[model samples]
Target chain A: MLWACLRFPQLAFDALRGTLPNTPGAFAVVAGPAQRRGIVFANAAARGAGVRAGQAIATAQALCPHLCLLARDPAAEQQALGAFATLAWRYSSDIHLREPDAVLLEVGASLKLFDGWPALERRLRDEIARSGFACRIAAAPTACAAQVLTFAHDGIALTTTAVLQGALAQLPLAQGGLESATVTALHGMGLRTLGDLFRLPRAELARRTGPAALLHLDRLRGHLAEACPRWQPPARFARRLEFESAAHSTTALAFPLQRLLRELELFLLARDGGVQHFVLVLGHERGASTRVAVGLLAPQRDAAHLLELARVRLERIALPAPVYSLALQVDELPPLTPPHRDLFDTRAQGGLDWPALAERLRARLGDGALHGLACVADHRPTHAWRHTPLDPAAPATRDATAPAPTANRPFWLLPQPLVLRTAPQRILAGPERIESGWWDAHDQRRDYYVVELRGGQRAWAFTEAGSRQHWTLHGWFA
Target chain B: MFTSTADLFALDSLPASTAWPVAAPATTPASAPASVPAARNTAALDTVLRHPGIWRRRAPGTSALATQPSGHAALDALLPGGGWPRGALCELLVEHDGLGECSLLLPTLAALTQARRRVVLVAPPYVPYAPALAAAGVDLRHVVQIDAAHTDTHWTAEQCLRSGCCGAVLDWLPRSDYRELRRLQLAAESSGTLGFVFRPLAAADQASPCALRLRITTAMNGTQFELLKCRGRLGGATSLRLRA
Candidate 1:
C-alpha cells in the first residue's frame, strides 16, 4: 500500500520569505553551534537585509540594521515538529522525525484503512488544504527513495532511483546541507551533480567528499536503507469538544472537530502526555446520538489519528438523520513517565506524570478519559459512589488510589446502612450518649451502645431514655 | 450496662443525600418528610427558570422602613412581624384563594409606607387583593410589579436577588421547585431586607430560607397565622395559632 507524497518546493520558507519580499530583508534560524538556544534559523527577509549564517552577531547586525533578529527556540520548533509528528503518526506509526522541522512516516499500514492510495492522496489534499504549507508525500518500495522523494518539489521527482539519479546529475552539491568548503572543493573539481560525484569512483568520492556527503549521496539515490522511528503519544490529559449545534452536514462538521483536536499539542506539551484510545460521539438533535469509536495499537492523541479514524469512518457512514450536535470524548489517561515498573526513572514538570498521560488520552480518546473516583455516602448500593471528572488545572495525583481529603467529612459515616426488617435493629450496644437540641422538642439526648446475639453478630445500638422505649442499631462492621 | 463497644457497628459506604430537616415532627420518624424538600417540577418545564424571587431587601434611604406587599394592605398594619423584616424571610400558607392569604399580607405592606418605600413584585401568577389592600391603606402606587408566565426559576430569582434597591420581593411559587428559596433567602439576608414567599402546599412548617416561616390561612373577618419556624434570637418556630 504505497501512499503518494507531494512536496511544495520550499513553501514554508517561501511563506516566511513572502512575508517581506522585495523589501531588503533577511531571515535565518541559527542553531547555536550545538545548543538549542543557538542561532539556528532566520528568514529570507532577514537575509535580504544582509545577515549571513556563521557570521558574528555584531557583523550580522551591522550588515542588516533593520533585520528582525531572534534567538533560536528549539522548544518551539520541537513542539511544532512534535505536533506534526503526532499528526503524521495518525497516518502511520512508522515515523521518522527529522528534528527542528521535518518528519517522515510510513503510511502503508493506513492506506487501505484511509481508502487506499488514490483516495489517501485526495484525502490528504482535502485535509491539508489551507493548512499553511504544501506537504509532499512519496511512497515506494524502499525507504531511501521514499525519504528522498519526501523532499522533492513534485511527487514523481524522487519516485525512482533512476530519475533521482538523473535529476541529481545537474543539482548543485551544496543543496544537501553540505558545508560550503566541501561544495567549493566539489565545484573546483567539476563534481556538480550527485550522479557526477557518484561517477568519480567510490574510493575517490569518499576521499574527496568524505563519509557524510557520500552517505547523503547514497541515501538520496536509494542505495541504502534507514528506518524512521515511530512516534509515541502523550501520557495524560483530557480533551473534549462541544459543538454549538448538532452537525447535520458531514462536510461542514470539521470546524468544531478541528478546534477540539487541536488541543492534542497543548495538552501533550503541558505534561509528557499521550493517548491510547478515543471515543467519538455524534450528538443528536435531541439527546440520543451515534457513537463511532476505535482504539489504536499504540497510544496517541494527535489530531492526525483522530482525523484518520473520524474521516475514514465518516466517509462511509451516512450522517445520522442530520445530527444537531457532535462531541469527541477521550479517556484512558496515562503519564509521561516511562513504564516505571521499577522504582526509578526521574520524571518532571512536576511529580507523578499523570498530566501528560491525561493529555495523551484526551488527545486520542477525547476529553472523557482520566477520571477521579468520588465516593458518595448513601445506603443504596447503586448510589454508593461515582467517578468525578478531575480538574486539569489542579495538582496532578501522585497516586490515584489514595484518598484525598476534602473540607469537612461526615461524622456519622456509613459505607452502607442496613435495611431494617423491623424496629430498625435491636440494640446490642447502647446508652452511649448523644445529647443536643435543648430549646426545641426536636432535640433529644440518647446513649448508643452495642448489642449482640440471636446468632452472635454484634451491631451498634442507640437507646432514647428521655423518649419512647426506642432502641435501634446504627452500625455493623461485619 | 451496655458496653461502649456495644453501640459500635461497621457501616457500609453510601452516597449522601440531604434535605431541610424541619418538616419532621420531633416524635415522628422522617422517612417521608425527607423527600419533601427536593421539589423540581419537570412537568411544567417552562416555569423552571421563570420562578419568582422567594426573597428580598430594604430599598436605600429609608430609616427603619420595610414593605410586604401581600396583594392586600389593611392587613399589613396589624401584624407583629411588622410588615416583614428586611433581608428576612416570610413564608405563606395557601389553601383555596390561599385561604385569606391576600388579606393577611396587607398590613405587612402598609407598614412599609410608614416611610414610603417602593416594592418590587416578581413573576406573580395569581390575582391580587386590590380592594382589600386598598382598604388596608397600602400605597399600591408605590409598587413595581413584574409578571412572567412559566419562566425559568433560577434566572428570575437571580434577577430579583441582584436588584438590591427593591424594598421587598415577593413570589408565588410551588415549594417543590427547588430548595432554591433558601439560597435566595440567604441573598436577602445578606442584602438586609425582607422576602415574603407564598409557598406551594407541600411543606406546612419545614426548614426554609426565611428567618421565620409562617403558615397563614384565611378566616371569616381576616386571616390565621401559625408560626412554623423562627430563626431570629429570642424567636423559635412554634405552631402559634393566630387569627388577625
Candidate 2:
C-alpha cells in the first residue's frame, strides 16, 4: 500500500564532476556533428570555471581555456540508460524515465521481499553496479524521503530514524524545495537545522513561516507526496518464450525472438493491426537478459519492415550477455483490418494483394524508402505532394479548387517551377486566378497567361499579379 | 557464360563520376544499348531516383488477377481473360462502338483492373470510382485526377497512359473511338492501355476486352449483348459472359 521513492542525487553533474579534472577550465563532449561539437551535454566541468549551465558555447569556451572535451554522445548515454533500465526493471516493475539520463524506481513492495531494510538497500546498490552505472542510490520508506535523501547524502540509504533525522536536518530548501524568504526568515531566526524546524508545532509552522514553508517540513517528514507521474504500462501484446536449454548463439536467440515476434504479429494481426513501436525483453539466460526498446516514426505491420528497423538499432546492441529467452512486446497500435473500408465485404473487390504487395516493397526498400506522396493542401502545383508514410487507410482528402492556368500546362509538374514568368503578363485564355489558404499560405494572384520563346520553343506560362518578368514553362502542346 | 571477373575485364572502362566532364557526352549511350542497364530515366529524376521496389516487383509473379473467362473464345484466349490484363492498363469508355453492349466489357475490365493488376481508375462519373473494382482484384493505387480540365488533365493523363504507367484509362466523355481513340489505341497497343468503351450502358456495339457484347447490371450480374453490330467473325453475341 505504500510507495518507496528511490532517487539519484545530482547524479548527472556528480558523475561528471567525479570524472572531470578540477581545473578552472571548460571542457565539453563533442560527439555527434562536425560543427558546434563542443556544446556541453554535461557542463559541470565548465561550471567551476564560472561557465554556468546553459551558457553560450562561445562564452563557455572563452571562459575556460583547458577543457577536456569528449564528444557528447547522447546516443551513448541513451544506450547506457537503456541497459540501466533493464537492470533496474529486474528490481521493480514501477520504473519511470526521469529522462534518458535519470530514472525513478518505486520499490516499496521490493523492500519486504528482498529481506530487511539494510539488505534491500545493499541489493539496490549492487544492482546499480551490476548495470554498469557508477550510480548513487538513495531509498526511503516515503518517495519524497528517498528523493530528499538521494539529494541530501549523495546516495546513502535511509533507514534508521536517527539517520533519516540526520539527513533531513541538514537538507536545505531551495528552488521551491525550500521557498525563498522562508530560508531568509529561518536564517534571521537563526534556525539552520531541519531538526530545529521539526520542534515547532505543525500548525504554528504553517502559520508563522507561511503555507509554503509547511511543504518543506511536510516533505522532510514524508508527509508530502512524491510528485512524479507514474509510468503507464503498455498494452500487452507480449508473449514470452522459455527454453529448456538456455541458448547463447545469435541464430538460436533469433529463433526464439522470431517465434515471439510471429505471435506478436499474429496477435496484432488478429486485432486488425501492426506495431509501429515496441519493447523487447530477453530473459533467455534464466532471468538474466537484455531489454531493447524502439519507437518507430511510422507504424508498420509487415514484419520485415519492423525487422530491418530493428536490425539497424540491434546492430548497435552488443548483448550485455548471451540470451536464453526472448519476449516481444508491441504498443500503441491501430488495428489493421483486411485492407478494406467496409469490414463485412469479404466479397469486396480485390483481395488485399496490395498489402501483400505493400509487404514486399517494405522489405526490399527500407521502411522509409518507399513513401506515398501525401498532397499538401496548397495551391502551388510544386508544393502539392509531400512524402507521408504509406498508410493504405489514410483518409483521402479532397483537393480545393486550383487556379486554372492561363498558360499551357504540362503532363507532369516538376515539383517547383523555375519561375520563368515572375511578372504579370498578358493572357491568351480566360484569366482565372486561384488563391486559397487556411492551414497553409494562400497565393492571391490574378494568374495571367503569355507565350514566350525559350530555347526556340514557344512555352505556355503564367505570371503573378504584380511581377511581370518571371515566366515558367506551364506545358507543351505536344 | 561469364564469371564476374571475366565480365569486368571484358568491359570497357568502368563507369565512374571522376570522368564526368569528358565522359558525360560520349555518344549519349542510351541511343545505343547496354546489357540491361538498371538505371534509365532523366538525370533530374535521378536526383530523386525513387528506389525501385515501390515502382513494381522486380519480376511480377503470377498475375494476382483471376480473370473470369469471357464467352468469346478468340478474345478470351487472347487474354489470360480469366483475369483482366494483369499489370497492364485496360481503358473502358461509356460508349459502344463495335462491341454489342457495354455489359460485355465488364468481365474483362473486371479481369484487367481486377484484384491482381492494382488498377488505377482515371476519369469516371462523380461517384468516386467504384470499390467494386477492388473486388475484381484491381489494385487501383488511387482515384485521382485533375477533374478540373482547366489544366491539361487529358494531356497529362495521355502522357501517363503513353508512359505505360497505369493499368487502364476510363474516360466518360461521349466521343466514340474516333481519331484520338485511334491515336490512343495505337498508343495503347505498344504502351499498354487495353482500351475499352463503356457506351451509354446501352450504346450500340463494339470490340474490346471481350469479343461479345452483353447487358450487364448489378441486379443481373451479366447478360450477353445478344445483338452484335461489330466484331466481324464473332460479330453477334449469343451467350452470357460471366462477370467475375
**CAPRI level of candidate 1:** incorrect
lDDT tens readout by residue for model 1, A1-478: 2333344433334334323445544655444554333234446666666665667666766877765655455554455556556556556767666543456656668866988666766666565454555566666544544545454434442334466566666655665446678889989987765557767889988898789878876766657765555567554433445555556677666666676666754455444566556666777765777787655434455666456556655555687576766666666655433332336532222222333333333333344433433344332212333445545343432334422332211112233333334443334333455666565454655655554424333444455655434555444322
Q: Give per-residue CA lDDT, model 2, range B170-228, as digits (tens).
A: 55434443444445444444454444434455443443322222343222322222323
lDDT of every predicted structure (CA atoms): 0.50, 0.47
Please give the clash total of every predicted structure, in order.
128, 74
Ten-residue region with minimum lDDT total, candidate 1 chain B: B6-15
CAPRI class assigned to model 2: incorrect
Scanning candidate 2 chain A in windows of ten residues, the lowest lDDT window is A402-411
* Candidate 2: residue A431 Cα off by (Å): 81
TM-score of each: 0.37, 0.30
Q: How close to the true structure is residue A117 of candidate 2, measured as C-alpha lDDT? A: 53
The residue ranges of model 2 lying beyond 4 angstroms of the native Cα positions read A1-25, A28-62, A66-87, A93-102, A115-134, A160-163, A170-176, A224-228, A234-478, B1-244
lDDT of 1 at B226: 61
